[model samples]
Target: MQLASNKGLTARNDNPLFWSLRNAFVRGDTNGLDRELRYSFQSFLLRNKFSKSVTASHKKLADLRYPYDWFPATRAMQRTIHLHVGPTNSGKTYHALKALENAETGIYAGPLRLLAHEVFARFTAKGKPCALITGEEQRIPEGTDRYFASCTVEMAPLNKRVDVAVIDEIQMIADQERGWAWTQAVLGLQARELHLCGEERAVDIIKAMCARMGDKCIVHTYKRLNPLRTMQESLQGDFRKLEKGDCVVSFTRIGLHTLKAGIEKITGRRCAVVYGSLPPETRAQQAALFNDPNNDYDFIVASDAIGMGLNLEIKRVIFEAVTKYDGGGHRVLTVPEVRQIGGRAGRYRTAAQDIKDNHTDTTSRPTSKNAPAGMPASAGLVTTLDDEDLGVVQAAFTSEAEPIKAAGILPPTFIIEQFYSYFSEDTPLSFVLARMREMAKLSEEFQMCSIVPLMEVADLIQEFPMSIQDRLIFLTAPANFHGTGQKQVLKVLARCISENRTAHLLDIEGLDLDILDIERGAADVNNTQYLQRLEELHKSITLYLWLSYRYQGVLTSQHLAFHVKSLVEEKIKDFLDNLSFTVEGRKAKRQQTRLLVERHRKLEEKILGDEPSNEAELVQEGPGAWSEEGHEEALMEDEAEAEDPVGLPDAIREVVSDDRLPRPAGEDVRT
Candidate 1:
């Protein structure tokens, strides 16, 4: 109490008003001392007011219990929601898309860029003014001020008002990693009429959302246009018996290639392949090859990538195995996965062609929004490659998936920016993100989106000095941080941004030119190391282009990155075309078919052994982060295969667990 000589007290006492009061005290002047004391009291009141204002701001940013109120513009408008609920091949998307086509101004938001491209192409072919927008790519028609938009879900324009909107694969609202995008589109899109197309499982959840918003919800249920039957007998592990219109579905890149090579070797017919990691353009090219009847590619060797919006003309669906490695661990496929993949078979082209023929003039065509619904396709057949998988596939087809309970959500950028202001400038970003997620007060209808990947990304770029806003932008960029050449490129880009310099892919340090070159050999096609490098390079270039769009002048190598990406895709296609499974010996052509089938069976046994049958343990699951132990185990298996010709058991134990393979340019990669 007697420490007026202390540094803090001495500094305060040195103020002019304090000096006046002290001088008055020393001279015994009571009037001057009272005036100085009044001045001090007024200063205290003003400082307290400013402190209260800051406390109020903090409270406002902390109140996140009502996320629906964030989008005030959307809430003020009267909206009508249409739910197109049906199984695959039931024309749900077709009808919803038709409504979008008829509207004066509308948007089509799909789960994949491939689907967005397809819709954009269709609208352009019909001579409609349309624009395509994805994370990495944007195409705007010349001289068109008013036009339709086709975009991926995450790229949907929330600020623009439209007459109609269509959101495909609405059931994805429950996805753990990316579901927030779907939920955001549904809630924030300023549309007079919004059409949501997907399975019936999403109906109740969406209706609940609409009820909260006071929007009218109307659900249209549809039955499969064609019959589908599960076969009792499997292929009995015989690749020789695969027919012309068969699609053999497997869960791994190696497994699909093995099937493709073995079938081509034995049957003397070419096979096309599709998976998640392959570029969407590459997947489309393969599908086109298989769909053309005159082509030598009479069969498809694919992963679950065919499940969503990819229309293939196949007579039968053959399962290589019912079990899949879902990043975290080995798990059985869920009911939705089995149904969606199995439903790609038996497309009815002639019926759709008949309708197209009747409507020769696009201007005079009847809109599907109000027209009566028509029949869709023909009967689709489903079976298994081995007897062990048949029972599991059949059971999955008969079962139903659990209904969704809540939509995923994350704080908007502005909300995050305000929250960041509460922390010191030097606080670690990972810590800030974790604290925000923990402190968030979520409503019962919404759950916090996974921030693990964001946190991981924050840790990777913590060494770089940047503003909080700039740091967030880098944190959200869809770039790989895994131990690969791509990770090196990502670090370089971060360094450039931190230093406020331009980034160019070609100018990056230790850049490998060989990644763009194709390795010419049959063995190289099956070489895991070679294929992984190719995929990594392709994804890295794509990530560069994605950032260039956002950063514009800062990342100035967009043109070169685009050129390299196309070249890489072509190399990938060439590699897939020449891929084949080879054995130790080969005899005459007639005997080759028989001998190859036998060897293929032996090869499979050596890799996967017999399938397991623990029915009770097959829990319904979603994609999750790959466990470190599982990834280490897979690396060890890869090493074993390189050391010995006989492959390690469970070599394909940990496939990329995403429903689709690694995402393309605009999409986030699984950790």
Candidate 2:
């Protein structure tokens, strides 16, 4: 029987039935494995003509254990994958977009409404069906496979299935108030695959958390596209000497305006302006004017807002100040902020390409005679924020609850996760909970009369959740302390917030030491003035803190009552102070003060009234010379006119401009 079995096994190995069985095993077909194995044995007996020896071999095969019985074959299947880590320029969004191009359905989630519009246009250009969903606008397409848009992540519906979801600027997950929204989006997104993009530090934390949650996380790091071209020497003398295409980056609105005026005065060339206060449409228009290839504008005077979104064709970036008021005090720019603004210079591809060609042909070409001063080495300068004592004061005004989650908007799980992200082992969850309890007690004791409604306040606190409320409390509590050395600091904050007044209250020379003392807790205090200042500062701080916690819904007049009172007190005090003189002096002061008082009263009334003022006034007047007749003709002189196609190097300038370039066959022209 043994000899017969060996012969049968050898014969079966060469049979077609046995070959089919083996193929089934290799392909990981479980049902096919069992069926084919049985068939192979039976077929072998029949093919060998069923002799006594073959029959005996079949009997022995039946007695022997089959490989299928020991191990079952299983197929490998594709699983949805998510990537959630990267810095600003790391191409995290780029990678996700690439995937979206191939996916049956995909969505690109952006943080801002403007960003959503930009992405929607980008995806639409790519010949993909896209939609925009922002708080201001929602445009959903019927039966669309992909969504290129922006929405408050917390408010976005999760029921819709997507093949892949890309969440841009995921670091917003740590935002004090709105962090909950991002956190919810990260946790609740139902896409088969998820992708997150943002700064490296924030991404690292997110990636770690995702790993802990059993989701696959991948990280991509990218250096800034344009690094600062550090100068061997600093720029000296007047800023008017700054060549065309230079960007003058100032910290303050006044500084930006002054720099623009100074540049125009010296160069006799009009400068374009871009800053935060300007509308998005205006900012875009200004950026375009500065970046125009026709070179219409000579210089751009801008604030830090220029550091984001719109691309400017800048050759050099000049810093008017290195530090900015961050709503608390003067603080130095963070590494990321500095890098962002500096990166704007030398980013103009057309300009950079030309510069590179000029450098390469310096020895061999005549064009090297005038290459525009080598484009100012693509460098930037840094300046210090003048008064450091005001940094904390500035922070106090701006320090409000970040609106991590809009009330009634985010999921419970997301709110919980957001709270968890803030605590390390050092700070216990119980401490945070305790703070929330204290806040609750305060709210109950100082509850506004029911005439206005208590439900609104309760709803506001409920909307923020305990974690967010406690965080705001902690952030603003430091400014509420009293002491002799802290008198000036407390008074400055109180005056600034209560009156909406920003003046040079502290000496610039002593600012650094004062700031250090406050931060170090080394300042001493025991005066009534200091205590009174602290009390006033505390009220302002508390108002901001409460507003931050309850700012999700439509704002009510009661909510703004304290702010109005503060403004009124500030105006009244100014009026009284200005009238402390002779009768004639007092009368003149009174007239001026009365006009201001009336304006303030009108503003207050407008705030309370259904109709708010929407007045538009010219921010800056053109020069008297420009206002005269032939100004346009004079300004048009020395203009490059039209770009000389032949003047541009062959390698740098294509026969057709990028806009007119012919598309490759089979490539999507929409994109």
Candidate 3:
């Protein structure tokens, strides 16, 4: 992309360094000095493109500041960006998708995995070969040439050439945690025609970004395709008055479950629950139940998980409370979230007539053509419980969206990792990411890719005795701090790296095989206690999937691991479908389940055999071993053992569950 001068010879102003070098050579300067000068010239050519630290005191990062300069594709393409700005129920995304559909080659980057999968399905169904790429899953049809791809924004391929690229939810760039992806996409995505879809509030920010990036920006302001009106009155915390097409929004899992159970108990109607932890498949199934007119799922109760690109025909949105417990304390929902979730009610479009009846179309054309058969089409309503924030909800009714101030940014994995290698002697494992950011800010190629994975993976691997590579692998895996399977996963990864082989579950020795029991494999059968373990296992599987993507051919066992994941998922799915637990007095429930937990404990000891147990073992039995509350309480009893594993090497950091505690060699563990 460097512009060349019309004349063959370099201009005198630009050739000052060239002349200086020539004069030195003419003056009979030492060959060693000439060699050093030539190396400097090589460094100038590479600039930020590379870094070389042959020894100490030789590294300078002056030429590596701009992220856009790294990508030839980004530099060469003049973006034709169309901003589809509007409120919910508007055809903003519809117009954007139409352009993508008509393009010879394109990509659609969505916020949610469900939305990305849906778009991928839609394109592939229309006889266009498409790829679906998400962080957890990737699918490219067998023996097909992909011309388009639908993926989460983080997975958007920057190097590929395409006619069009659709970046959805452009306003999320202001999000404190995930907004960096949208910013990176806006600044770095190399596409001929870029469609940015989101609320009107982001219009100005996007225009400024486009101008800075040297891309032509076209603003398309739109009104709601279907009107959405705020309800004058609130629900006053009443669940009995709820009917079909009502969406009750709660912020916590406990509250959502309690509300859903109460609603079902009173109205004798099935309810669909959508929460973040629920899998994409489960969420889709729940939405399908609510969308189908004939289904028993008359009402929907969900968390803020429904606040994004999910489309549903909710007649009314009832916020259970105005304030949410945001980790630290209760806080009011932001104006943008209020609008995004509220807009789900009364979507404009409807299903094609005679889809299930006169037309009898069974071709799976897409949800757009299948769902929303009957709708009011005119207006929607957004309300809250107890009138706590009626004014707040109403403010979003007319006000523009809140402007985004900053985007999230993660540094390049390889570059920052290399930087850290030079400082491993003094650097603590806990601050690896923090240090990477500081160094990345100093780099020349630091423009867009600063969006780091916001969540911490595992309680930083405790065993520091292992190599940096092993520790880093564990750090990067999306592992739960208290997960039982993480220790084994680390062992397996170490073995794999050592042996230069992929590992399956059976391949790892000394693993607590008792976890294979998805149903707890015990007598009294308190499935609730087993569920905690299952959730941990699910997270472990997710870590494997993520690692497999990073290592590709190195983790060939991921496909087999998925088979085990399916078994665990089936148990989870069935349990959630018939969600229940013994709801009796704590004394009564424990009395009935005590003998059961004891039997399970003895069986687990037999499984562990003679292996010396670590203090880190998480005991499943003891007081509070039935409900999720009790399970957590039981875990808390071993709180002293759950030290933050920041200093230990990943190899020795054991995630021992107290399925059993120590007893005399011959005596049964006290129940």
State the TM-score for model 3. 0.67
Clashing pairs in 1: 276-661
lDDT, candidate 3, 228-274, per-residue tens: 77888886656677767789886544445556766787688998887
Q: For model 1, how does the per-residue alpha-carbon lDDT over 1-671 read when each residue is reduced to its tens digit?
A: 23432432322213334433553332222333453455445444533443566756655775677877889999999999999998887778777877887899999998766677778877876778999998778898899788999997888999999999999888878775567888899999999999999989889989999998989999999887667779889988777877777898866555566567788888889999866456656766887787777778888987666676667777789987665544332345778888888887765442233234634322232212111124223557899877766887899788898777768778888898887787677666776565565346666667666565676677678888888788788766766444467667777888888897998777886455576654755455445565556656766776688788878778898999888878876766565555555432111111222232334344334533565421111122232222211011121112222222333123122223213333355432211
**Cα-based lDDT at residue 343, candidate 3:** 84
Worst 10 residues of 3 by lDDT: 615-624
* lDDT agreement of model 1 with the native: 0.66
Question: Against the unseen true structure, what C-alpha lDDT does each candidate score?
Answer: 0.66, 0.40, 0.57
Whose TM-score is higher: candidate 2's or candidate 3's?
3
Clash tally for model 2 = 25
- Model 1 has how many clashing residue pairs? 1
The residue-level lDDT of candidate 2 at 601 comes to 37
lDDT per residue for candidate 2 within 555-581, as digits (tens), equals: 133334344434433432232222211
Q: Flag regions of model 2 displaced more than 4 Å.
A: 1-93, 101-104, 125-127, 139-146, 152-159, 175-178, 224-227, 232-237, 251-262, 275-281, 348-671
Best by TM-score: 1
Against the true structure, what is each candidate's TM-score? 0.75, 0.43, 0.67
Every candidate's CA RMSD: 16.9, 30.0, 17.6
